[model samples]
Target: MSSLPYLKKLNNAFTIFSRSYAFKSDLKIKWVRPEKIPCFKPEKSGDLQGFSNINKSETILEFQNSKELATADNNVKKLFSLEFAPKKCANNLYIKNMMSKVQRHELDFSTIETKIARWTGIIRALQESMERFPRNIRMKVTLKELIDRRKKHLKYLRRWDYKKFEWLLETLDLVYKPPPNHFHWITRKESLKKLTDKYCDGIKEERLKAYRLTLENEQPAFLEEKIRTLQFIRDEQKACNVVVTVTEEEINDVKNQLEELKKKNAESNNQLN
Candidate 1:
C-alpha cells in the first residue's frame, strides 16, 4: 500500500518533467518562406519591355506622316496617329527599338538578339494582359513557354558570344536568370527545424554570456580568499622554521592582481551609474 503513493508521486514527477521540456506554444520562433522570385524582370522605368518612348506622340509609323497622310483630312490624320494605333503597332515599335545596328535588316529576325527581342515584346504584352486577367490559364501557359524559350536563347548566346550576349541584355533591359544548378524545394518542416536550431543557438549564447559575467563578478572574492590562504601558509611555515613554498613575491603578485580587478569593477560600476 505504501508503494502505491510512491508510484503516484513518481508518475507526477515524470509528467512535470515532460511538461517542462515540451515545446512551448508561445515561443517567438517565426519563419516565413520567402516568395519565389520569377525568372523574368523587365526594366523599372518604362513599359514592360523597357521601351520608354514607345507610347510617345512623335513615335508614329512613317506612313502616318507620309505626304499622303499630310494632305489627308484632319480626321484621317488623327485616325492614323500613334494615339489611335493598336497595341500590336506599339509592340512592333518596341521590338524595333531593341534591335541592334548589326541586326537591323528587315529579314534578320532569326538572329539570337532579334529572337530574344521579339520574345521580350510578346512576353511583356502577355504579362500586361495577365495582370488584367490573372486566371487566364491559356495566356499564363503561353507566357511561361515564351519566357523559357527566351531563357534558352540567352543561354546559347552567353555560351557562344558572351560580349554580344551582354550587349543584348543591356539593349533589351532584360535580366537573364539561369536555372539553378540544383533545385531544393522549400518545405515547412525543414524551415521550422532550421529556425528552431537558430533559436536554440541564440539562447545558448545568451546563457553563456550571463554565466561568464557571473564568474567575472566572483573573481575578486576568490582572489582575496586565495591570498589569505597563501599568507597563512607562509606565516605558519616561517614560524615553524620550515622550507617556505609560498614566497612574498607570489603573495605580492596576487595582491596586485586583486587590486587591479577591484579598480576595473569600480570603474565599470561608476560608468553604469
Candidate 2:
C-alpha cells in the first residue's frame, strides 16, 4: 500500500513536471554550453548538483575582444544568484514574467533551459529599471530595450544543489511544502538560508524590517528549530539570549514570499490574478 501511494506520487510528479515543461525543447537533454544545470535521463532524472560546474577553472579573467563580454561573464554568477535569490517575490515575478515576455518577443535558443537563462537576464534588466522610480509611488515601468540586443547565453544558478534548486523551483510554482518532516527537520533552515541568499536581493532593506519584528519575542522558537538541525543551542535561555540573529529584512522577505504564494494556488493549477 505504501508503494502504491509512492507510485501514484511518481506518476503525479511526471504529470506536474510535464505541465510545467510542456513548452520545453528536446535540446534540454544536453547541458547548454555554459549552463550549470545538469542533465538527467528519464531513468535517472536530472541532477541539480552539477549547477556548480559553471564555476570551474574554465573562467578566463583576461582581456576580451569586447569589454562588455568580459563584464557579462564576470557578472553571470552574481546575476544568477541575484535573479534566483535577492529579488522579493514581486521582483522575482516581475523578472520571470519579463523573461516570458522576452521569450515571446524574440527567437534564438533551441532549448528551454538556455532560453530560461537568457530570459532571466532580460528580467534583471527590467528590475534595474524599476530602481529609478521613487520609493513612495508604486509605478509600473516596462523597458523597451529591444530583445535583439540581449546577449543570450547559458548561466548556472548554483551547482546542481538538488536540495536548493528544488525549493527555488517551488517558489516559482507557489505551492511548495517541505519534504517529509524527518528529511526536513534539519534541512529547513539550510533551505531557508539558501532562499534568503538567492532570492532576497531587491527590497533587502524592507525585508529586514519585517524579520526583526517577528523575532522580537520568538527567541525560543528560533532556538529550538536551530538546535533540531544546526544543534547550536545548548540551553533555551542561551538561544534566547543571543543578540544578533537572522535580520528583519530576511524575515520580511520570507514572509512576503510566502504571502505572495498563498495569494495563488500553484499546485492546484489556478492561474494567478
Candidate 3:
C-alpha cells in the first residue's frame, strides 16, 4: 500500500520533468533549425562557351539557318540547339572547356585535371537535377560522392602541381572548399543555448541603455535637489549656532558639475540636430 503511493509520486515527478524539458513546437528559434548548405558547384560549370567567344554567336550545323533535311526550321533549330540542349550536352561542354589545355588528346581521361573536370561537370548537372527532384535519394548520394571524389583529386593536384591546380580552378571557375580539421555536428541543444544567450544579452544591453538615458535625464534635477538640501542644512546649522557639516566649497563643486553636464548635453543635442 505504501509502495503504491511512492510509485504514483515518482510518475508525477517524471511527468513534470518531461514537460519542463519538452521541445516547444510553437517557439520559432532559427538557430534550432539546420542551416541550408549552399551548393558548392560553380555557377558557370555548365556554360558551353564564354560570353566573348566568337563561336558562341555562331550556330551549330544541326541548328544552322539553312534548308536541309538534318536541320529543322529556325524555331525548332533554336529549341534543339546547344544553348537549349539537354543537361548531358551542357556537362560535356563544361568538361571539354576545363580539360582543353590539360588533356593530351580526346582519349585523355586518366589525368587528374580531366577527372576533376568530369566530376565537376557531373556535380553541376546533378545539382540542377536535385533542385528539380529533391526527393531522389539515389541522385543526392551520387552527388555527394562525386563532390568528395573531386575534392580528393583537387587536394592531390594542389600538392603535386600547384600552378596547374590554380589554372584548373581559374578555367572551371570552381571554389575548392577543403574539409574542416574537426567536423562538429550542430546539435539543437547547443544551438538553442547560444541563441538564448544572445537573446539575453540583447535584452540586457537594451535595459542598460534605457537606464543610462533615465540617469542622464534626471542628472540636472538631482543636482539641483542636492544643492538645495545642502544649502538648507548649512543654513539650519548656522541658525541653530552649530558647526555646519556641509561646506560652501561642496556647494560650489556641485554647481560646477551641473554647469559642465548642461554644456555637454547642449553640445550633444547640437550635434544630433
Candidate 4:
C-alpha cells in the first residue's frame, strides 16, 4: 500500500502516544495553571552545538571562495563517529554536545563534517517541526537565515570545486539541483525566460501564475494609455492642420510602450498554456 493512506494513521498514533497515560506516567510536569502550559525556556547561544559563536565563524570561513573540504586523508564515514556506536541515539546526543566546539581551521575533517552536518540537521529538524506544529516565528526567521547560509556554501562549492560539490550532495543526500544559469532581471524577456524555465522544471507554479496575472491585468491599462495618447495627438494634428512633429513622437512612444506590454503579456500567456 502507498504510504499516503497510512500518514494520518501514523500521525494519530503519535498523537495518542503523546497524550496517553503510559507516556506521561514517568514524566514530571511543572504547571503554571491547571489548564495552561507555560512557554518553554529558550536555549542560550552555543547551547545547540551549531549555534555557538565560534561554530558560526568557522562555518562562515569554510564557506569562503578559497576554502575547500579535503576528503583525501579524512574518511567521511568517521565524521559521524557516534552513529556506529552501541547506542543508536548516542550519535544525536554527541553531535548536540560537540559540533560547535571545533574551530574552522582545526585541520580535522571529522570536526568539519560535524559542523556541516550540524547546520544541515538543524535546518531539517526545524522545517519538519514547523510543519507538525506551526506558530514559531523565531524559529522560522532562524531557519530562513540558516537556509541563506547554506545557499552561500552551495554557491561557493559549485564555483570553487565542482567535484566536491557533487560529492557533498551524494554524501549528505541533499536534494539540490543548481541552476543552469545565474538569474538576472535586466530585461523583460530575460525575466520571462527565467520564469518559463522554472515552470518547465515544475517549480513555483503559484509565483508563475502571479507573474502572468500581473501582466494580464496591466496590459489593458497600457492599451488605454496608448489610446488616450493617440487621441490627444490626433486632436492636436486636427487643430494645427499640419504635421505636428512633437505629437508624432509622443504617439510613437505610446505605440512602442503598448507593443512592449502586449508582447510581454502574450509571452506570459504562452508560457502558462
* lDDT (C-alpha, whole model) for all candidates: 0.77, 0.41, 0.73, 0.55
Give the 10-residue window scoring lowest on summed lDDT in candidate 2. 38-47
Ranking by TM-score: 1, 3, 4, 2
Query: TM-score of each candidate?
Result: 0.61, 0.17, 0.56, 0.29
- Please identify which of the two predictions, 1 or 3, would achieve the higher TM-score against the true structure: 1
Top candidate when judged by TM-score against the true structure: 1
* lDDT string, candidate 1, 129-159, tens digits: 6767878888778878888888888898999
- Where model 1 places Cα greater than 4 Å from the true spot, the runs are 1-26, 31-53, 62-65, 70-75, 100-108, 209-273
| Candidate 4 minimal-lDDT segment of 10 residues | 38-47
lDDT of 3: 0.73
Candidate no. 3 TM-score? 0.56
For model 3, the stretches where C-alpha displacement exceeds 4 angstroms are 1-32, 35-87, 100-118, 133-139, 156-171, 220-260, 271-273
Q: lDDT, candidate 1, residue 149?
A: 83
Error of 3 at 129 (Å): 3.3
Number of clashing pairs, model 1? 0
lDDT of 4 by residue, 1-273 (tens): 599779989999989987884543222322232243212211211112222222211222222333333332234423323333333244344345444443355454454345555666566556555555668888778876766566666777678878866666555556453334876436644555555676556646777888988977987797777778777778888898987655666766777877887788799889999
Number of backbone collisions per candidate, in order?
0, 20, 0, 0
